[model samples]
Target: MSSLKSICIIDDDKIYTYGVSKIIKNYLPGNDVMSFENGKKALSAIKEMEQNNDELPDLILLDIDMPEMNGWDFLNEFQSIRDKVNKEIQIFVISSRIDQKNQEIYRVEWDQKVDDFIQKPVQVEALKDLLA
Candidate 1:
């Protein structure tokens, strides 16, 4: 896979973030990986970047459940700035929820917007695939 300049991870779990960030750093040294505990903070930062006309991250690792603003809420708000943000910015949904019905719903509902959905306890292989 080609190198990514930057990636953003928006998840509430610190351990998960730490683990994923570590793995990413190990695999792709020098890549800028930013993590946010909630969607609101991430959104605010993205908006600020937009205002500054700065380039967006190449990918966003988004978690479905979070406080203040969940993944779905983030998507709703993100839609407003869709044009402003780089269209190449891919969003990958990561969640622990294993409900097949919920998965099907999200697949159908957000297929066009979200690049992919990954179940939690995110695998290194899965991350590799994404990076690929």
Candidate 2:
């Protein structure tokens, strides 16, 4: 697969963010990787980009649990404004909340916005495939 230009990582773990960013940078040189401590900040940046007519991230690595705004709420908010954006953004849920897979909420909100789900301590091989 071809490489993506911009990738966003939304998670609270600084170590996880740094490690993942390193892997992505090494694996896909020249790719733009940005990180947000929480979904609220990520969403705000994305919305601002929209208003400024700037290019949004091509892919987003999302976490289910976060402060200020959880991944679910972020997804909802993003989906609400999707129509206003012209680009296709692929969102992959990368969270440690494996139990969420069995919840009814996944079946509902995930049907449209989320492209796929990945467990935390994100597997390099799987991530490589996504980044590929």
Candidate 3:
């Protein structure tokens, strides 16, 4: 697989972040990976990168729930700057929530904004799928 120029992981769980980062590193060595504990920080970082005319990440793994700003909030902010960044950038929802209703909402309402929905405790095969 071709190496991604960059990727972002937005989640409140440190363990999840570490695990995903490790998997990404193992599969796509040398690719830059930026992570944020919440959506607010991630949004701020993206804005800064935009201001500097830096290329946005090729993909984004976002969590649905968070303390400061959730994934939904980030999507709102992301829409505001969508034109400033790469419109083709892929965003994958990674959440531990098992709420069927919320899943339906995400599938129906936010389908256009997100690429795929991945469960928590990401597996190596799933990571490989992402690479593929």
Candidate 4:
């Protein structure tokens, strides 16, 4: 598979971040993989990158529940700055909550904003497919 230029993992769970980054590095060596503990931090960093005319990540794995700013809030803020970023970013929500109601809400409300909703403890095959 062709390597991706960059990927961002926004989650407070350190173990999850480490595992996902490790998997990404194993599959797409040399590609940029960044980890942010929360949506606010990621947003600030991305905004800074935008100000400096730096390239943002093409893909983002976001967690719904986070301190400072949650995925829902981030999506709302991201929409405002989407055009400012040069990349056509794809955001996927990776959360532990995957009830039918939540999925339905995503389908009806967040369909345009998010690419996919993945369950927590992401599987290796699923991650590979996502990377592909």
Over the stretch 1-132, how does candidate 3's per-residue lDDT look in tens digits? 665558899999999899889988987688788999999999999999889988888889999889899999999889878865555788889988836777787789888788888878788888777866
Give the count of colliding residue pairs in each prediction: 0, 0, 0, 0
Error of 4 at 130 (Å): 1.3
Q: lDDT tens digits, residues 1-132, model 1?
A: 567668899999999999999998897667789999999999999899888988878889999899999999999898788866546778999999846788888989998779988889988888877887
**lDDT, residue 14, model 1:** 99
Backbone-clash count (model 2): 0
List the lowest-lDDT window of 10 residues for candidate 2.
98-107
**TM-scores for the candidates:** 0.93, 0.90, 0.91, 0.93
Query: Per-residue lDDT for 18-45 in model 4, tens only?
Result: 9999987886677789999999999999
Question: Once model 2 is optimally superposed onto the true structure by TM-score, how far is the C-alpha of residue 46 displaced, in angstroms?
Answer: 0.7
Candidate lDDT (C-alpha), each: 0.88, 0.85, 0.85, 0.88
- Ten-residue region with minimum lDDT total, candidate 4: 79-88
